[model samples]
Target: MEKKELVMNCTLALHGCRTSYDRSDLDSWYLLGTYEYDGSKLYLNTLDDKICYCDRYDATPLKSWDSLSAMLTSEIERIFGLFDADGHCIDEDVPTTPVVI
Candidate 1:
């Protein structure tokens, strides 16, 4: 895809998150990270950089932003349940930004 289109898609895929793209050579844009959402499953690169889809529950790989978002929301809910109503996670430790490629 074109750089502009790829940037736009990444932006949409990473809603509520921040991202940065590298275009050092003008011929390519590199998304820096091991985690990526490719409009399908959330992929994690192994130590050797082999792409692997995240399937936490042994269910089908996540196939859309909605599914990923729901999973995150559920996790947040579970974490919140562990604390009192007014408790909040540490700001710096929480992942407020996500990467999409």
Candidate 2:
């Protein structure tokens, strides 16, 4: 949980949205945090876990929806290493030994 929180916080600090997954019994959902942006300057909650945000040009107001689809797609790309195909780790044969200090 701590690790997850840290990741969320860091992401929010960087991108204004720290998108993350919320695993529950029935289903999973995307978690989004609050933010305030001034054109390009963005100010968001460092404790939130969201990745995407949108502001419309309507007079009523804007809504906040969990970007589950986008977050999942991004996660899939990360897990499969498709984003950086050449950066995958390689497992090579190596000798191991034990010594007494």
For model 1, how does the per-residue alpha-carbon lDDT over 3-98 read when each residue is reduced to its tens digit? 434433332232323243332333221122222222333332222232223332332333323344454554345434433433432343433233
Winning candidate number (TM-score): 1
**What TM-score number comes out for model 1?**
0.24
* Model 2 ranges with Cα > 4 A deviation: 13-32, 35-52, 55-67, 72-101
Per-residue error for 3 in candidate 2, Å, reads: 3.5
Alpha carbon lDDT of residue 8, candidate 2?
31
**RMSD per model, one decimal:** 14.2, 17.3
How does residue 40 of candidate 2 score in lDDT?
A: 17
Candidate 1 regions off by >4 Å?
A: 1-66, 88-101
On lDDT, the leading prediction is 1
Mark the 10 consecutive residues where model 2 has the least summed lDDT: 92-101
